[model samples]
Target chain A: MTNETGAPLLDVSGVTLRYKTPGALITATERVSFAVNRSDRFVLLGPSGCGKSTLLKAVGGYLKPSEGSITILGRKVMEPGPDRMMVFQEFDQLLPWKTVLENVMFPLLDARNLSRKEAEEKARHYIDKVSLTRALHSYPHTLSGGMKQRVAIARGMAMEPDILLMDEPFAALDALTRRTCQDELLQLWEETRFTVMFVTHSINEAIKIGNRILLLSPHPGRVKAEVVDVDTASPTDGSAGQLEKEIHDMLFSQEEAH
Target chain B: MSSKARIVMRPLEDAGSGEVERELSFLEKAWDNSGVRKVAIILALALIWELYGRWTDNALLFPPLSDTFAALIDNIRSGVLPARAWTSLKILLMGYAAGIVMAGILTIAAINTRLGSDFLETMTAMLSPLPAIALLPLALLWFGLGNGSLVFILIHSVLWPVALNTHSGFRAVSTTLRMVGRNYGLKGFAFIRKILIPAAFPSILAGLKIGWAFAWRTLVAAELVFGVSSGQGGLGWFIFENRNLLEIPSVFAGLLTVILIGLIVENLIFRTIERRTVLRWGLQS
Candidate 1:
């Protein structure tokens, strides 16, 4: 699926997003652009105030860019569709009334128009992948935070979307749980090599998960730099630490300059 | 030189290592059982009522609890009380069902569109505060001494609170759940059935309960008015007739029957529903 000449799977060209509150029109991102190729672990990295999440939402078709365009496989993104599944950060993202199996099968039944048996089969398969097969009948509130995220991921993965858009999915988890969840996500990716566009503020996470990273500036986010060839750099070695430090310095230097 | 005087302070051994479990005493266990406690309270109240009624020596106003019980048993054995209760319950069910249906429609509309929500708010605001019994005269004039008048007032009593509570519940459904529904391409009725209903079920259950209570009370009140001239009447009519005939014990029996029915429906019917739904879903304790 690696292509140097063909059009990227997801194309975000000069997109800007703005939202309105009761009084102010807040510009979340401005002229942010990136392309995600098939099977790419593309990460959007930025500081707290930056609009990486907003950008991801725009790509997910939940938010429309105030200016510019986002296209998925040459089709203009207009609204939230099953083709762009999202795994949110909140533990409450899973439907509390739905058992883990039902939560995973919901999108399959709704979007894929699968029969009940087929949906159940597909849902169970994904649940097994996330090691949540034992919790198939358990409700969301009964599950731990990590387990809920797994269910959410299984739900997203079960749909077999063109690209999964994850917005800081492990950010709310404890450190040990977060690490385990990150590892599980990578293992799932290794098995399926599914394309994912992940948004996070953690540099370590970006270095570990993303093959290609897009760094954005602070509030009213704009593209600052793109770090490529991340997969070739060994994560446990001195080079990974060197790269982390260098990116940290670049990000901070930009803030210092302002 | 003072090495012997130097003492070491060490942490307590096996601190927080395990939990202790103990068997409860008979009294403690009985106290823990809500059903047993409730029955105890009821028995105590009945004893107090019997004592007070005997001391006052006023059979016309406050009959002894024992007398009321005997009257209740006599009415039950004659099947008159059961027939009247069935009549009231039948009418209550009809009005309640209709009210619930109307509430469902109004709530669906209220959540879906701006104009629909405005309409619901306006109607509830206008009608909710106006007591259902207050409409009894108009209902009597329009429907004319029948179940129609009773049902009209009963529906009036049931509709507003159900609609208001359902709307509020629907509004309280989280935005993330709505987004999840939209993300799956669910819209219209599917959206409501899949996402909104379950998410807002606790509130909806509360609405149903409030509506049931309102409908029950309204049916009895309306029946009281209708029973005066009608050949056949419900429990309310029975109570009114007993009052007129100076059968105070029978009147107390009629009131006891009403209370019993209320308790049954609230505990058995509504509590069972709560146990199966909101409690099971962990939406409510």
Candidate 2:
């Protein structure tokens, strides 16, 4: 699970994302570098608009870095591919027209060289795994908020991507629902051992779900700190709340320093 | 207290609570029954209209609801209204279908290329403000007093709104949805079919509503001026001929039929479809 073999499951090096403005360029993230091993739950922790999601987008191939490069499974990613699936923040990520099962089967239709029967089988498998077997025929609109995210998660997992990138996927749900989904996600990860790069603002969520957390500074986001805690499985019941608060204070100390 | 007294008091209290709960449940059920409520309202309005129309003395001003219904029945039995209605429906469907198809192609093209979008915007801006009825004289000259002329006018009525709404709908689709589409590696028609079309459906339905109204009005006006097409007269022709003969009640009959059809189409067909699709999906309230 190291890059010593000259290959990593996910790799990002010297990545900078900038927006070109009329008078000057606005940088969102600068000099970001990390490599994720196989089955690693890597979390990018930052406040809103800190370019954490932007970095996820960069890895997902939705956006290209202004500088540096990204590679997955030793292949340089210049464009979005089915091999790197993204679970978006919005629940509408699952197409409303599709039933839950169909939504999960969508990528297989486009990405894989599988038959319809094969795709359906695989989709049902993932749907069942997400505890959505009863909702297989239900449309996204009929599902509750937590249910919608479960469908999206099932859709991404069914794609069997080398790396799954989530852009604050549970942020919009209610607190209780978010916690439930967080635990479900952790359980799913334990079962599948899928490589995941999750972006979140909540330090509590980051510590609970991530094996390693990368702290990003606000406004022209940059790497502030990186902590690898291999101690706990996901969905920590506030046991690590003190450690998370410490990280939160350190990251937000800009206001205090000023 | 005596055991007999306690038994009577407890039973009486339970009965009272049960009755109140039952009434509350009924009210709750009624609150949830929106579809039933809507139907009831429509029926009540129709009844009121019928009663009012019958009470009116002037046949020229307000033909009794019975008279309108009887006239509609007579025309249908005589094969007059059906033939004419069929003709109108044919032209309407043809021109409407063609307009929608062309608009869809144009919107897709517009989304893909900057030049196409620019051209579409300019063309829609130029045409949308100009009434479709205004194009009749030119259409008559070009297509020469037939179904072709009516179709040309119909196209003028239907095209711009569909194209404009579709283009905007495509533009309005959230980037997140688009990214999800791309993540699946869908390109070209596949992407549009799976993502753009469904995401843009609400706006497209609105465009369809506008297009239908525009086409309906334009068809009637065109037929009034042009008379008939391919020797087959439609509802518009029936109205025009009745007016020329100064048959006021018959003209009222034709007008009433038109209004009825419009209402039926709007409330029953289009709205039903909208409810089952966008509204049911919770994409639209």
Candidate 3:
């Protein structure tokens, strides 16, 4: 995929991920190719164990693919760096000891050439962006699941990474909270225009948040389908119900077939 | 309206105000009070002990709380207690500080190297069960009748618990947290500081508490066993001396001081720390 405005933010080509456990070498994903444009909300949707999260991890540079390569803004990802930050499913992703503000400020402290004051300012900006200004001094234990994820998101965004990787970050949240967070994420993206690669099993979430959704098959996940959201300019409106239902049906039938 | 219907209606009309009044009365009566029960239990235990002490009439074997407190007051007034306490505390601090520093370095080294970690695990496995008091005689032989001997035993008592706790805490930090730290480009000491240390804090705090208790107990016992007084002996030495002289109440006094100190350190210092850090954070079970 070629973009006219700017070069693609993330280009993942023929990526294959594998894991070796006690007995056998398990193939997680195969021949996966995708390009996320600058500020594109790219979503990977699949069944459990279909390597959606693995793909996200690979992009975040936590997992080196068994084969092929991933590049962010023409720079190849070799190892985990400050270029890409990830929001994880587990609320415990935030360091329990650090307050909400501290957790947000964490990435900036390690990033190059930022003083404590500067980091604090940057962290505060992102924390406010995530609407967690009220909970700044409160520890992770005091925050609810949604609040914790917001802190994680704030922390990830504070780094100003080239791409934000989310591995089912809202999967643990309740329905009402999940929708609210999804809306907030879209708002943040609209404002900041940071690239995102999101993984989720929920079709509704994929359709609602993703600019482009890529579906993967189970058992060594291969790209089954890609749906472009040209018709819906805005992701979250009451009218997207039809689109959500259609995608839901597609995923359900796909699962039934397998 | 029928008579029976009128009776039912009248009762229902009264029920609302009566229910509220009953609820208020129940609240006033303290329907679910545990404070009284707790006080009662403590008083009952004290009464039993007093009765038992009266029956035995043995001042040496089982001194009453009153007798112990009186002796404690006398010793404190005479100034033998304060001077000896200071000496013991100094030794305790020195040994405890040394042990903590050593354990921290070892843990850092261990975390970085597989071989170091394996070695630590093996050594801890071998040495954890060997009592600190049991090392007193050996410590005496090595350091020869001074604070050095007491220091050695205190170090032995402190090292294992602290090392074990720290190492395990470092190990138990979530992999996701580590990955997140690395994702932000933190490595080596930065990673351990920002990610591992905080994540493992509850465990580390537990270790510190245990190590402190061990060190405190070991220091006194070591002193008692090897009391070579250059005009100063710790609480344990004081007790031993008092016992030898057949000053039974003073012996009881020394023992009481030890208990008091332990209670103060544990409840007043360490308990507050646990409450503020681990319990407040909801990290500890």
Candidate 4:
């Protein structure tokens, strides 16, 4: 792995993650490495079983890497903290017992150790950013799938963490909602420019969401290539299709070789 | 053949003529109220009982529903039924609360460690199926002729079900929710208090209901076997005394009191708690 420019905000070097099943020791990722600079939308794009989610979890400090290390601000990642908040794919990530306002304020009031008043104000700001002011008192179960994900995103964003790790946040949403959420996410990013590490299987989403897309191979995922789309072109432009086709051809040719 | 048959499709423009919602008849509306439906069933049952009692025509045998009610009123007026009910309710509360506290301790410990988990599983397996009343004879030998023995059996009946349901509920909390909780740096007690407890509250409430039922029945049954404890007795003893004195209507009245208490506790107290918590949260419909 190459260290680009000055100090990267987050550095994951040769990280190898493994877990034990009842009968087997499974390797999820093999020496997969990348660095996410501050304000970069870094997307880990791969197919199912490619260990992108596992890698994200590793960065979030929920899972430990067996062989290598993950660091943010030169501090070794050991366990989950407010420093790296995760927006999960499932709606159950928001506590059902808590209202939307409370859910967003949870980590703010907790790990951030903010005053209740400060937390509520910050929570409200983020919730409003997600356009969920109307649902401040609603429970997760009462909200639609998209709304739940938005609350999750708001909760993660409210913490103002070093990096926000999103594990296919919009993957469970309906297509129309997914598109809308992605646009909203980009708009939010444009407004704040907070660093985010997004994991997704959708290539179109990868291109649309990431400034730097890291393609991973199928199983025991190893980084195949890091495609830097310096143009900042979205799918609305014809160049996105060109880049998509190029990435597809590269993946297809690699599969043919295998 | 393809050219001859073209597909004809029509979109649903106004599917229900803009009147999808309609008003129901008065009877239909009444049928929708569970309380009304239950009352209707009760009236039908009372009519059957009155007819059957009249056919038998033996006051010594099955007393009429009206006679039973009259007997119940008579006992209440004499302050006999109220005193007995109070006696039973006091003992029931002591036993039920103690049992709940023990269950909570056990469940919290079980979720925290392997040994505690094993202890809970083994205890529930061994004790839950063995009827609590079956322990009364042994309890009497140990505690001897007092409320102590009855409380002992009540604890036995209530502890297992509450612990079992709570353990399972905690275990059944979704992995995603657990991660979300931990991701906020909530560890150990905070994790259990904020995440696990409320997440598994539906099962906890069910366990409470089951424990209440078990403790109530065991209390009554124990009273029947050893009703005289330290010179006072409960409703079960009231029934036993009336039966011995050939007061059949009074015995029925005692039985009616038990049913009434059970109905009120279940429909009022537990129902209110459920509505305020799990039902309000939509965890249980």
**Candidate topping TM-score:** 4
**What RMSD does model 2 have?**
5.6
Model 2 agreement with the true structure over A29-144: per-residue lDDT tens digits: 99999888888899999888679998999898887899999988778998888999999889778888778887888788768967899999999999998898999898888999
Error of 3 at B192 (Å): 1.2
Tell me the tens digit of each residue's lDDT in model 3 across B121-151. Answer: 9889999899999988787789878888888
Model 2 CA lDDT for position A170: 96
Top model by lDDT, which number? 4
Query: What TM-score, to 2 decimal places, does chain A of model 2 have?
Result: 0.93
Report the Cα lDDT for residue B29, model 1: 96
Worst 10 residues of 3 chain A by lDDT: A230-239
DockQ of 1: 0.74
DockQ for every model, please: 0.74, 0.64, 0.63, 0.74
TM-score of predicted structure 3: 0.86
Better of 3 and 4 by lDDT: 4
Candidate 2 clash pair list? none
Model 4, C-alpha of A81: deviation from truth (Å): 1.3
Deviation in Å, model 2, residue B231 alpha carbon: 2.2
Report how far residue B170 has shifted in candidate 1, in Å: 1.1
